[model samples]
Target: MPDFLIVHTVLVTGAEGQLGRQVIRKSADQEVEVVGLSRLDLDITDLAAVRKRIAEPVTVINCAAYTAVDRAETDADAAYSINETGAANLARACAEVGARLIHVSTDYVFSGTSERPYEPDDPTGPKTVYGASKLAGERAIAELAPTSTIVRTAWVYTGVGTDFVATMRRLEAERDVVRVVTDQVGSPTYAADLADGLLELAELAEAPLILHATNDGATSWYEFARAIFAEIGADPDRVQPTTSAEFVRPAPRPAYSVLSSRAWGAVGLTPLRGWREALHASLAG
Candidate 1:
């Protein structure tokens, strides 16, 4: 808590999600009043409901997003409705109530063609429906809630449940060789770590309008899988590296989505530990 100026109640949307759950858990240790709402509880697309729920001044962290990348190709309406319209509703509500809005975004907003890490002000050319919708949402929030913060993250997993890290663990037990793509590279952000970082942002009185956050460092999917296998006492050698062309999907995954920590550090904000160290700690439990 450290006597940060955040004295208002904190409301989190998408309470059942990986990030939302971690935010709730992290909030328990901090001196803050938090109320978490799931999809069933608060449909952000319903503007009337949003206005009713957020009638007072409070800090709102929005984790609600339609994140099915492949499905988003055919379900553009649903993706935009949730990711864009829903986010706009929250931003509008926050502005009316004088609440601080912190919305979670994805790195898919980029075209994935850059060699270096993505900066917040980098040119954006989303290549998929999902990315387009998220980018739209980011823009809507910026226009509606001028003082809000939009944080774009990549390759997030909690190491438990149905996330990529958990799937890797399941595959390690089910098969000897797990083939993963080598061309796709991004930051691997542990949900718990991301949650801690967001809470830290909440404590600040002011912050950049848009910023990037993730566990430090980057790696390809193949290397990340091998690291996971090694962490769980499995044979890392059994993991095979493949290419994106071999396994096509409805959505064109970004080949490079690593986000830069330069803006994050420049704001005097705390950075999450390196990816490997966080991965080791995630599997330790």
Candidate 2:
């Protein structure tokens, strides 16, 4: 390693999660020392637990979240406790310990009515309980840790996790056709790619307080499903396109979840590859 390479200790919350697992795996060859903590190991909702577990001089990567979109509608309190309050707890703990915080957020923070992609400073109008709670967490971290970095991504999928790519692959094996919503659009991000981006941000001397990091380009759910099928050597025609109204869920999805990466480029970091390339690499791996 170079003399300038500061090998900081990194504490990863939600270590068992898709993105967190990737972060841990990628850090194996890097200069950083990583300590992964699952929900069982550290209950971030408990402030004392956060402070006790995160007392070391480290960079904290908060991948823990209540990610069940539809379930959050009925379980609003549970979602808030984890997503909002838990985030605040981690922020406060990091501040006390003088650790840098990198909080992972979602594109759901926007209402998705904009014709273009959303900027980091765009006005937020979340449409669901999950989105609202995540936005609240972002606010809490911003207020508590002024130097913390908040990375908002969208349509994240991983090979091992129960994400869109895995779901489509499973459905392709099980059923003749898989119906996907055509109206909902966003950038699809592979977990490994996202992990790399976060680690890059961690090494920066100074980064934007808020940044958007996702695989480049945009596509609707229907298109994304078709690409996934094509990558797996399955019949793309079997994946059918339907509007959001046909399959109504408890949570309202944004019609457009695409986020702009201009801020990401402005900071002098190379943007991630396009969604199609990332999807192929993830499935192949």
Candidate 3:
């Protein structure tokens, strides 16, 4: 890290996550000192552990969340443990240290009924427990520490984890055909792009910054899967488009979770690439 460049310590939770890992790797080039902690190293749900960790003055990036949308319906308690209480703990800790917290939220915070993209200040009406918990997390973070940022993103995918893109790739390799829900519309965000946005937020000396960061364009899972197939040189026809009713899950997904980047721009930060461009880049990797 450079001495004159105002080097700061970054304490990143969920270090093994796709976005968290990307943040750690990319910070190297930017010369930012990072303290990446996995669940084993530090679990946010444990208040004692979190309080101890945040005693140091460091920029905190929380990427941890119970993200299994379907499972959350049956396991709301588990979801709330990490997403609600855990978030509050981290926020309070950040407040104690007088550090800026960059918390990653989700589009599920919205009901997804709007024809237009969701703004940062829009009213939240979560339809599922996962959504509700994530929204709680956002609120907790904001209320506990006014100097925190809540970044809502959607349709996230990366080389790691079992995301939509990876699932599509797996199905393409095995099945002759695949069924995807077309009713849900949202932008697919590359973890790498999101990581960059976090870095930008860390550099800013602002408080209570709520931003929506994702790939620019919107698409349904059907379209997203077809694009993934096209990139992988697989048969796009094999990926069949189905309605949400036909592909029922335990949790209810928002029909449209598209988020606007207007708030991110307010801070003079450019939005991420469009879904098409990001999809191509992730597939290439």
Q: What is each predicted model's overall lDDT from 0 to 1?
A: 0.94, 0.92, 0.89
Candidate 3 displacement at residue 203 in angstroms: 0.8
Question: The CA-based lDDT of model 2 is what?
Answer: 0.92
lDDT of 3 by residue, 178-204 (tens): 999889999999998889888888888
State every prediction's TM-score relative to the real structure. 0.97, 0.96, 0.96
For candidate 2, the per-residue lDDT at 227 reads 97
RMSD of 3: 1.8
Q: Write the per-residue lDDT of candidate 2 for residues 118-222, one digit (tens) a residue.
A: 999999999999999999999999999878999999988886658888889889999999999999989999989999988888888668789999999999999
How does model 3 fare in lDDT? 0.89
Comparing 1 with 2 on TM-score, the higher-scoring candidate is 1
Identify the superior model by lDDT, candidate 2 or candidate 3. Answer: 2
> What TM-score would candidate 2 get against the native?
0.96
Q: Highest TM-score, which number?
A: 1
Q: How many clashes would you count in candidate 2?
A: 0
Candidate 1 lDDT (Cα, whole model)? 0.94
Which portions of model 3 show Cα errors greater than 4 Å? 1-5
Candidate 3 lDDT for residue 249: 80
